[model samples]
Target: MLTIIDKYILKKYLTTFGVMLGLFAPIGIVIDVSEKINKMIENKIPVVDILIYYYHFTIYFTNLLFPIFLFLSVIWFTSKLANDTEIIAILSSGISFTRFLRPFIIGASIVSIIILLMGFFIVPKSSEGFNNFRYTYLRGDGKQAMRGESTDVFRQISNDEFIYVNSFDVASKTAYNFTYEKFTKDKLAYKISASRIQWNPKTKRYTLYDYVKRTVGGLDDKIEKLDKKEAKFNFDLEDLTPVVYIAETLSLVKLNRFIEKEKKRGSSNVNVYLVVLYKKYSIPVSAFILTIIAVSVSSMKRRGGMGLSLAIGIAVAFSFVFFDKIFGTLAEKSSFPPLLAVWFPNIIFGILAIILLRNAKE
Candidate 1:
């Protein structure tokens, strides 16, 4: 059902994209290794682990910069076609420009689907490993990467229940100075305090040390004490000591459930997670928008040839990344809506795509 021209253009689009990615990915890996090699040596990290870390980082970096590579590749190859007068020949062959764009749209659709799958499935796993290694070994400051992984935790578990811990060790799944309180109608109902609390993976329960409980009555409170107690609580250790990269490691379904749970917990850090969620969808859709814009901008031949097109494409790509970072930072630091921040660059670039396409058509 497809014509020869359609097949040819489609092949060119995908082939150029593939070549661009293949060429640049190694450069990225080399630079990353060069930067981290000293740290790996200092830490005496194994050669196999270093190689594995770079493997995860390669996927992470490629997916992170997919839109830029996609835009530049489209512009690069299309500009070449224009300089060779191939576009003019195709147009003169009784083919409308709109029909000529069919292959491009098809190519964008294919790439977008792959990007979407990478975001939802592959990237999360790669990011977890990549970030974990980078934070643990390559960087001396693990707290910045993992956030509250080894800090005190305090949260309102429910309207009537509150919990606190003086300090927690994620590696050991243990907490010190643990406290839980229940209240009714602005009055304390019961309170429990313990010197230590530890998660027992084998039993799937918490063991508390030097446990104490207080039950309040009208004018008196009954106090109970124990050396140790095994119990279960309504929250998980992950909920207590949240890592900054926690959201980056979840699939779409798990991400949605985590977001809903965080909302119920009244967490102030929900916007950070929301930004992650919205960007996963936004980044893939922007690939289609950027492809349209890239094709439009480079389809016409200029005296400057491919250089001019590549310069313009790279400039536009950098601006897209800049705007995304600014808005994303605003969402994380200020009261800006995460959904709006994530999609604003896409909305603006999509409009640019339309205007450029119209001008190219004219």
Candidate 2:
């Protein structure tokens, strides 16, 4: 049994959300196009391709900024309602403030479901195109495809296996100063060192330059040397070194498997992937929390009307973004846990929402 007030408020909430997207998305596309237009022209990129890129850009930017839009939209319409005395009339009609919040929660739930679906299924595919266009035409080709924290990578591939590479060249499919070592039961079993290693896509094998292999026995070590050799190792090219956007291009299932595999490999950059994983889950939950905060704050009719409410909304929105970035950076650079970093913003604001909601209720 949907009351008139519930229907009215729900319509307003969802309408404002859609209108916010309509208002900001084109502005974003325009600014993005302006910035990239010169590069597109210089690179002789086709108009159709550029337009397609903006289509993906629209999706990417809209998803990236959806929470901000949602927060602002809730504040806008609710403040308008407060100004018009609609909330006062409704409350005077014997409706509890908690009951009044039902439609907003319902609206938030709807938006959260949409966003969760987009983040998991659509964003990954669109991000691939958006990033490919940036790297290929916006940035120059021949640069290292992957941008790990360090060019010189060292990792434990297993309990007794370790690998090292000084640098990798994505253009040439080659690694410099490559080494792999294997140990068994606390004894060195074998070690392989090479001046360079190149991947052959067709043959699916590695060509090692100036390769040296040392096989250790109980009391003695046997060494073998070769100028060049084709070898098959336990890892693939993506396993040894993946591009920065690799995680962004994977679906939820693949991303989890990737993180687990990286954890097993003792990769130093696993935190980065974990951050992405946590954010997908966090964003949806934040939607509901932010809706509560927005509705509670804006439902009051302040002396300055919609202007004051919007000012407060903007401040809170920026604070959310700031907290998100600060903690995300801390997680990546320091020992801060990725899960904590992703959820900390939601936790802090959720507490704030509770306090505000209590005050609003009283």
Per-candidate TM-scores read: 0.84, 0.79
Predictions: Cα RMSD each:
3.7, 4.6
Question: What is each predicted model's overall lDDT from 0 to 1?
Answer: 0.85, 0.85
Tens-place lDDT digits, model 2, residues 1-362: 77888999999999999999999999998888788777677777778778878887888898888779999999999999999999999999999999999999999999999999998999987876676567555664323323212356677778888888876654366777899999899878999999889999999999999999999977888999999999998876655554466677678998898889888777788888888888889999989999999999999899998999999999998899889989987997888999999999999999999999999999
> How high a TM-score does candidate 2 get?
0.79
lDDT of 1 by residue, 40-153 (tens): 676777788778888888899898888889999999999999999999899888888788899999999999889899889999888877766765555544333222233567
Worst 10 residues of 2 by lDDT: 141-150
- Minimum summed lDDT over a 10-residue window in model 1 is located at 141-150
How far does residue 246 in candidate 1 sit from its true spot (Å)? 1.6
Off by over 4 Å in 1: 141-154, 160-203, 206-231, 241-243
